[model samples]
Target chain A: MSEKNKSDMLRAPFKLEYDYERSTGPIIGKFFEGLSNQQILGTKNGDNVYVPAAEFDPITYEHLSEFVELPETGTVKSFTWIDQPRKHHLINKPFAFALIQIDGATSSILHMITNCNESDIEVGSRVKVSWSEEKTETIKDISHFELINE
Target chain B: MSEEKKDHFISPISLDYNYTAGAATTRFLKKVSEGKIVGQKCPKCTAVYVPPRGSCPRCGVATEEEVELVDKGSVESFTIVHIPIPGNPIVPPYVCAMIRLEGANISFLHLIQEIDLKDIRIGMRVEAVWKDKSEWDTTLENIKWFKPSGGDDIDPSEYRFKGPE
Candidate 1:
């Protein structure tokens, strides 16, 4: 601990751990259950159907229980390319995180687009769900979306 | 917005990080390892900050001049915590005080014990109670807590003399 080298430092390891436990309730709980079975479900609000099922109508705010089975296919409405994957990313290689407009649905689902290069995907590119072989009743059941055209 | 209420989702979230102390803070903690307390003086505002963050948060100037401090201090404020901290051995109803160490401009939180809960007050005189020398390390935890030292309590105005907000 000399004066000349007092500034030379060591970093201490810090871990913040806690249990994130809560009830997903009915609407979101049913949505996750649908994913485990490889089913795409949405809620019908008049003419517009929202994927990831909204519990209430967007306009009238009425309780919505009428569910619709949507097709797995979708079109990329907007997207951003990631050249390098970070530790927490699901995909190990370069991928695109795109806002997809699922077919027969009014809104978009933010999902990953993999197995394609930077120029191979765009706003209008068609893609479909690539299901994980091991489903966990969570969002990851849809492993990622793949280019339906290429 | 009410929905169907059932089914529990229990997920454990955790993050591992490395916090490297800055030059000023590293030196301050090192001093605490040797049964001493230190503060860094800000060049612009001239405020002495204990456990310095290497810069003046108010004046936005670098702090390098180090000032060795006495272990004695005054309780600037205090609160009795009735709720127990998870995994902690200390029982609730214990006093946690904001202590401004002698020669330090800012107050820091620390446990105040060895006195009755009713006796705790603002501007009370207290001194650091250190653990055994062999168990010391580069941690402020080396000074276990502050205890009533039976001296003149600092004038309440002394701690309230900081420049304008």
Candidate 2:
């Protein structure tokens, strides 16, 4: 048993490619359809209405269907710096990923932060939706999240 | 049961992927239809790759030459797929293995046959049993399975490779 032969037995390399198709259920369907119409929809959970219509009530885990519209401008509740990105992420470069709570909405949506440096970003920062010139049914149609000056 | 008893509905969704072929794998699959085993040799490292490969991981260079390998090989590792993956073409309870064939430096993954799950030994020798000539295709299914290579259980250390039974 030579060391060279042992190494070969241990780690044999192979490559595999797989194709995956995900079914967007009714909840996500309505949200994407709303985005296509240039209108944002939210779900009403008791007294609070949330944007990007929540799939289920966070507390009760109930299917939420009540819909409402909210202003595009929002406040950043929490944020993180994504230095190294993975495939299908919103942005490729080092950018801040933020949780934005739009006005008239209780819950928030996760999106990327843009046009601001690491020094400028804070948890309580104000942000606005910079919609894309080419609108699509996908979430990226919102373009990039812009930092709104206080 | 009245006139309004028509309460049945069904829906079905099917998807197909136009899979692209890689360099060495394309050649390997082509040979399988002709009932042959093929391998690729690394130009820099000199290690032979079964089921072929585009590049040598060690040398980081494209494998240039095509080489024919022995249909017989020793199992390196194997798993029984008891559960069926949805939309998989093959039936369940099939054995998939990484076999270290003679003359090839690396192993290739394929199915093994003519042996039971309990009788399978890690160091047991096995030979490729090809499918009927009429049933050959550009797929790994051409080699039905590796059966006992006509030898009794030998010392694991004496054998060059110890594949999963």
* Each model's DockQ score: 0.54, 0.03
* lDDT, candidate 2, B90-158, per-residue tens: 787877777778777677677777678776656567898887999998788888777778666434454
Q: What value does the lDDT take at residue B101 in candidate 1?
A: 90
TM-score of chain A of each: 0.90, 0.79
Which residue window of length 10 is worst by lDDT in model 2 chain B? Answer: B5-14
Instruction: List candidate 2 stretches off by more than 4 Å.
Output: A1-18, A84-88, A133-136, B1-109, B112-126, B129-165
Q: Clashes in model 2: which pairs?
A: B75-B163, B76-B163, B113-B145
What docking grade applies to model 1?
medium
Summarize candidate 1's per-residue lDDT along B34-128 as a digit string, tens digits.
Answer: 98888888887788888788888989988988888899999999999999866678888899999999878899999988989999999999999
Q: TM-score for model 1?
A: 0.75
Model 1 spans > 4 angstroms off: A1-25, A59-63, A133-137, B1-20, B40-48, B52-66, B82-94, B113-119, B150-155, B162-165
Q: Please list the C-alpha lDDT of all candidates, in the order they appear.
A: 0.86, 0.73
lDDT of 2 at A30: 65
- Give the number of the best model, judged by TM-score: 1
Tens digits of per-residue lDDT, candidate 1, A12-73, equal 99988777766666777777778889999888978989887888877789998888899889
